[model samples]
Target: MHVVQAALVAFGVVFVAELGDKTQLLALGFGARHSLRRVALGLTLGYGAAGLIAVVVGAVLGAAFPQRPIEIVGGLVFIAFAVLSLRRDDDEEDDDHSGLSVGRLAMSSVIASIALTILIAEMGDKTQIATAALAARSNPVGTWIGATLGEVSSGMVGAAAGSVVGDRIPPSVLRWLSAALFALFGVSMLLGFP
Candidate 1:
């Protein structure tokens, strides 16, 4: 695929994956308590760092393995992601920030805290894994850029809309949509559709 096409595909995949995710909820919570600018900046930094790591590892793995085998594995991984997405509980509580007091932190501290929290929370998250898988099959640089942008954009939606977003869009709907997309991608890859 062309680099731009890869990036666009990655963006769509990651963006849909992030909708109704816990990290987006975190962004909503922080947005309710802090400035949107800070929340956005923090999310951008954290997602960028995580995306960089994912793509680099994926690039290395892609280079190390034969292309056909890698595509097959990537397809399986995407199918697994679809199953996992369906299995996620939509009613799960967002209690990750129970201990932190955002009011007491300075501006820079708030940004750092948010960034660190996201980085830690997303280290092994499905989005990161999906990003890695995408990089393994597509253009690593494109995947990195698109995944990072997708993550940031979804986070920004939560931050901008706050709790209103939660009230409007059902998490289950997003989950089902995301699962379908993953399944489609997996099936396409497995069948060598592209």
Candidate 2:
């Protein structure tokens, strides 16, 4: 039951954090410009790397700070990100693409870009704190597996759709939904939702 709850929470948080994110746009743009499968590869690998880093950071911080303190910080930070999401982006996320090639370059460059973008974007985010909280409530393996699966699953869907749709979705609606989801998570964490 706890595991189930953790998985659900993990999926919800990561999925919400991903919508309207830079990495999501990157995935979409890369998908449209390149092979969807290849783009998925790059994006998945990138997101995996970032998630690993986040897990490690979450573990360390979870140890250093009490759960509530870290959660408070994370919730506050995510609120800021949510607020930013509510506004028009100064530069649309899909504005540029770095030159990418095949073989090693494809794996290295594409994956690296995705990983870096997501990592920077998610630093001190509610997603990370949720991962930590889930870890506390569930077994380590369960938490890790749930986190990995949740993020990768959502990422694949986003990458596939982003590649084909590529900004086809209504921008205003996406932003509003993203902001609402993020803010909901913040409030839930701070207030300890029932």
Candidate 3:
């Protein structure tokens, strides 16, 4: 029951947070060049690896610190994430490919290239940090599963639909929605509501 609940919460938080993120834009770019299946696979693998690391670290931190303090800190972190989410400039060009030549990669290298790109991008990313915070307050296994799925789902959507989805839904709308969810989570944590 705890695992299921944690998974649901983590999924909602991460999925909302990752919408319109740079990695999703990367997915759009990559999917344009590579097979959608390959992109989805790469996204799953990359997010899974990152999610595992985050949950492990979060679990360790949760074990080390008192629950109340961890909750307070996690709440603060979520609030900070909310503010940061709103501050991001949506109009910035997303042509930066992290110097990876997407066109030159061989068929076999596509998955690896995409996976490596996603892994690199996820380092210190808001979604990763949020996953860690959620894991600290919930079940690590569930959090990892949910976070990985959430990230991969968003990326898959990007890969499948291209920029159409982004174009259809204004970035400001996603940003506001994500910010609201983060703020809600933060407030809930601060209030000691599980």
Candidate 4:
């Protein structure tokens, strides 16, 4: 029961945290010009590193902080992110694959850049906070594992349907749905819902 609950929180938080945002767009834009497989690999590895770091941090913080504060902070942050998402405008150019390849710098550069961005962005982000709270609910190992699994697999969830076409996943209803989920989760956490 605890594991199931942890998984739900993990999946819900990570899956919603990554939506029709800049990073996802960058990955898709890279996929548009390069081999989707390499792009996918880069994204997966980059996100894996970020998720691992987040889980570790969360585990540590959970051991140190009270649950109520963490939950409130996480919920507020998530709501802010959702509102920000509602106000965002996408108009960036694709520079993620300007000089990479299916063999050399492609995978390395992309992975490095993505991991860096996610690390910086996730430093104190709501998703990380929520993940920490979720981590707090379980043992450290389980928390880390659950968070890693949830956050890492989120990319695939966002890009699943269109990924079948050997192209990047389009920001379809998936993005909206993920955003909605996040907002809802945030409110639930704020309200201390079980």
lDDT of 4 by residue, 1-194 (tens): 36666666677666676666434543443344334554566666666665566656755655677777756875776576556434322321223544544434535654554455344345445556666676656654555555556555555443343345324344444345435655775686689762
Q: Candidate 3 overall Cα lDDT vs. reference?
A: 0.72
On residues 53-79, what C-alpha lDDT tens digit does candidate 3 reach at each position?
Answer: 778774464457676765677577667
C-alpha RMSD by candidate, in order: 10.3, 8.4, 10.2, 9.0
Candidate 2 residue-pair clash tally: 1
For each candidate, the alpha-carbon lDDT, in order, equals 0.72, 0.57, 0.72, 0.53
lDDT of 1 by residue, 74-168 (tens): 56766776686576542233233434454324455667766865664465567888999988888888888899999999998988876454456
The residue-level lDDT of candidate 2 at 179 comes to 67
Q: What is the lDDT of residue 100 in candidate 4?
A: 43
lDDT of 2: 0.57
Between prediction 2 and prediction 3, which has the larger TM-score? 3
At residue 160, candidate 2 shows an lDDT of 78
- Candidate 1 RMSD to the real structure: 10.3
Clashes of 1: 0
Candidate 2 weakest lDDT stretch, 10 residues: 89-98
The parts of candidate 4 lying over 4 Å away from their true place are 1-5, 58-102, 157-194
How much does candidate 2 score in TM-score? 0.53
